[model samples]
Target: MAKVIIYPTTSLILADLVDRMGHKALVAPEAVRDRVTNPEIKSPPLNITPEEPKKGLKYAAVDVPSGIRGRMALIGPLIEEADAGIILDDPGVLTGCAGCNRTNELVRLLIKTKGIPVLDLKYPRDDTEARGFVARIKAFLEGLK
Candidate 1:
């Protein structure tokens, strides 16, 4: 099974779709779950502790833009662990959070750099589109397997 990274990482639709297609979703919500709710662990970018601010800077320490380092801290690991991806680019969703654009871009870039098979798609607006979306995703996952 491929470990696919689903962007907007909190997207339940993509997560469910990935699972239904028989793949592992390295979603942000699942990855950061313990860190966010568990008091012992400090979440970065999302819920940074005093010490985590400087952490994970190396991921974005290069010629990339600033402010993204913190966001990368959370995403970098998941991307590193992923073998494939499915991105739902829905402009109607306001393009996700503010910094997410940069983070998402970086994730896609990294996925490309890693030479993984990534399926990029627009969020379905209707039942037909939704069915097409599922078919496309299933095809992608099957190809990986």
Candidate 2:
């Protein structure tokens, strides 16, 4: 099965769809869960180990904001591991929000440059559009197979 990275990594709906389509959805929660559950990361609330920032630097430069670096630490590896990707552009907060515009842009750029099949879609505003959105995603996932 393809390892598909879903942009906005926060979107459960997209992740569910990808899972149902028989592909792996690379989302942020899974990454965060790894860190949170790891015994080595003793920092609660923050959940980030000291080495996390250094890991992030492999994806983002030193000049980038620490917040972006922190996020990229978790997400960058997913992007690297992705065999495909699905990105929902201009999504509302409820739909999906990565919480950092620069990170969002950087993630999108990385995914696009990965030379993998990527389906970039806009957020659906109505029932008809939602249907089409699912249809397109289904088709994309099917193609990956």
Candidate 3:
């Protein structure tokens, strides 16, 4: 079975979907806040934070949802080391997505498994968009097999 890692919101939607399909969808224990911004990122929120830098370097990891953080930081790496990795996370920065984001705070660090692939889901958070998102994920899983 392919190891599917999804965003927290997406993870809730697909919780039963993965089980019904007999694939393991790991909803892990870490939070979205854990995917904190590294000091190197020169962007706002991450960059604008008032945290002091330690010799020009600041460790700004924060607490996020348990769903996406554990997968990106823990499960994704594990899958890569043994089996192939299939990461499923929302590409959008909005929608109150409680997980690792495009600024790639955590994904950049752990996604080293060569065969692993990270699929950024595209949709409008509407019915049609949701269907399209599922369809895209199905296609992605098919490609892995």
Give me the candidate number with maximum lDDT: 2
Candidate 1 per-residue lDDT, tens place, 27-97, comes to 77665575777666545435655444356565676565555666676677888899988777664454343
Which of the predicted structures, 1 or 2, would earn the higher TM-score when compared with the native? Answer: 2
Ranking of predictions according to lDDT? 2, 1, 3
**TM-score for every candidate vs. truth?**
0.79, 0.95, 0.46
By TM-score, the best candidate is 2
Lowest summed lDDT across 10 adjacent residues in model 3 is found at 51-60
lDDT of 2 at 111: 94
- Candidate 2 per-residue lDDT, tens place, 1-145, comes to 9999998888999999999999999999999888778786679965886677788899888998888888899899999999999998887788776699899899999999999999999988899999999999999999996
Say which prediction, candidate 2 or candidate 3, comes out ahead on lDDT.
2
Return the lDDT, model 3, position 47: 41
lDDT of 3: 0.46
Error of 1 at 51 (Å): 4.2
In candidate 3, stretches whose alpha carbon ends up further than 4 angstroms from where it belongs are 30-104, 112-114
TM-score of 3: 0.46
Which residue pairs in candidate 3 collide? Answer: 30-66, 31-64, 31-65, 32-64, 32-65, 33-62, 33-63, 33-64, 34-62, 34-64
